[model samples]
Target: MSVQVKDLKVYYRTLRGDVRALDGASFTIADGEIMGLAGESGCGKSTLGRSLIAIDGRMRYVGGSVSLDGAALPLDDQAAMARHRFTAVSLVPQYAMSAMNPTRKIGKLVTDLLRSRGIAPDTVLGEFRRRLELVGLSTDVLARYPIELSGGMKQRVVMVISTLLDPSLLVADEITSALDVSTQKAVAEAVVEFRDRGFVASTIVITHDLSILVQMADSIMIMYAGKPVERASTDAVVSSSRHPYTRLLLSSLPEVGVRYEEHRLSGIAGRPPSLLNPPPGCRFRDRCPLAFAKCAEEPPFVEVAPGHSAACWKA
Candidate 1:
């Protein structure tokens, strides 16, 4: 496994109480696998990604362990995680356009970043230029400031920079959410291309777009209010999901050929439960159409079919 997270719990401290952002999220991403994490807003997908790289001040690592390539990650210790940040694990955050420094030229910024990480600038020069070319950007872009590039260009630049050290795992959090359809496709393809070329071993593509996930991910994991509701291969999750939440989510998606006028799609009826003080048992119980008295108890994420797992009483 390239990445293994077991019962990882990360909470945000507030005057109200501890918001359990990531409560017992456990999964594994095999070598070269692209895992897609899908959920509605505030479902803790971003929290899970951020915890792997850097936990913000308000966030606290409550429990569980994370391992990359069989080595434990010191996620709780911000200073200690510095040793693994770029070299072992990297992130292409939600706003890739704003990730670059406004003042410095792209090339200079890369050099400064490398120096800060104790890596000599000259060491990766050839690889850097090669990566730029692979991403369809000219070497001259090195001289341009962040302001000179378009949103798509900036996103691509961030992708190249994030994978510069060839990390074992890459966390891409809604990296394509802000782009147009064509640009989004291009960027999404570039992510798979990076893995194909061994620039990164495995990747976690976190987004609420199931259609995009269908195009890029090998496996899909559905989360509902700080817990995994279902996990399976992309094909299985889309075509034969067992979990009610997964079924509702998949049904809500409008495919390219499917038109609303002919086949009007219905969205999930109720809003996602608030994570601040979420309900007892399954968090999705209130919204699940198939929820029963058994739902009063949390369902285990068990395999219903080969490579298909769901956490629902109905399943």
Candidate 2:
């Protein structure tokens, strides 16, 4: 395993109470694997990604451990984690256009970034130009300001920068959400290209788009509220899901050729439960059609098929 997380619990302090953002998430990502994290809004997907790199002021590391390449990550200590920030783990944040500095030229920004890490920009300048070309950007883009590039261009630039030192693990949080359909496809393909070219050993693509996940991810992990509801290979999760939540989610998606007029599609009726003071037992009980009296007790995330695990009473 390249990445192993055991019982990871991260919470956010609020005036109301501690919001259990990530409660006991455990999983592993193998070398060269692209794991897709799917969940509804505020389901702790972003919290899990951010916790691995940097913990914000609101987030409190309540428990658990994260290991990369057989070494434990000092996620709680900002100073100690500085050594592993960009080189060991990198992130392509949600907003790429706003990620860059408008005042500095792209080359100067890269130079400053390398210098901050005690790396010589001159040594990597040739490689940087090659990478820019690899992403279909001109080498002359190095002289341009962030404001000069379009949204897609800026996103690709951020991708290049994030993987400059070839981080072992890359977290791409909704990187394709803001782009048009064609641009989204291109950017998504570029992400896979990064892995193929050895720019990053493994990646975690966090998004709610199951269709996109089907195109890019090797494995899919579904989260409800603050806990994992299902985990399996992409094929198994899409075609043989045992969890009601996963089944409903997949069914709700409209395919490319599926027209609403031809066949009416229905969305899940009830909304996801609030994480704050969540109800006892399954968080999805209120919305699950197959929920029963046994749902009063929390269901363990157990393997129903080889490499397919779901946390549901019926499963």
Candidate 3:
């Protein structure tokens, strides 16, 4: 496994209390695998991704371990994690389209970032330019300010820089959330190419857009209230998902040729449980149609079929 997270728990420090955003998340991503973490808003998909690299002051590591290629990550220590940030693990965080410095030209910004990492830009300048062309960006973009570029252009630049060091793992959180359909496809394809070309050893793509994952991910892990409810190969999850939440989520998506005029589109019924004070047992029990008295107890995430696992009694 390129990445292994065991009982990982990360919480948000708020004025009230610690919000259990990432509670007991455990999964593995194999080398070269593009694993998609999908869920509704506030389900901890982004938290899990951010925890693998860096957790800011507001976030706290409650417990658990994250290992990359068998080496444990210092997720609880921000300063200690610095060495692992770009070379060992990297992130293209949410809202990456506007992540660049407004005052610095693209080239200067890259130089400053490399210097901060103790890497001289002259050493990787040639490869950086080549990567720009690989992602359909022009070398002339280096001279332009961030504001001078379009949203898609800015996103491509960020993707290139994040993977410049060929990190062991790349945590991409909602990287395509803001792009147009065509641009989204382009950026998604670029990510797959990064893995195919060996720029990153493994990738964890965190997004609520299942369609995008369907396009690129090798496997899909469905999360609810910070815990993964199901995980399986892309085809299995889309066609033969075992968890109730996974089934509901797929049913909610609009079908390609189905008309809402005849068969109205479906939607999941209830709001997700609050992470601040979530109830015991299955976090999805309140919204699951197939939930029973057995749901009052926590279900273990166990394998049902070969290579497919789910955390529901029905499964």
lDDT of 2: 0.92
Off by over 4 Å in 2: none
lDDT measured at residue 9 in model 2 versus the true structure, 0 to 100: 94
Per-residue lDDT tens digits of candidate 1, residues 24-114?
8999999999999999888889899999999989999999999999999998898999999999999999989899999999999999999
TM-scores, all candidates, are 0.98, 0.98, 0.98
Q: For candidate 3, give the lDDT.
A: 0.93
Return the clash pairs for model 3, or none.
none
Q: How far is candidate 2 from the true structure (C-alpha RMSD, Å)?
A: 1.0
Candidate 2 Cα deviation (angstroms), residue 47: 0.9
Stretches of candidate 1 above 4 Å error? none
Q: Give the 10-residue window scoring lowest on summed lDDT in candidate 2.
A: 269-278
Please report the TM-score between candidate 1 and the true structure.
Answer: 0.98
Q: What is the C-alpha lDDT of each candidate?
A: 0.92, 0.92, 0.93
Candidates in order: C-alpha RMSD to true structure: 1.1, 1.0, 0.9
- For candidate 2, list the clashing residue pairs, or say none: none
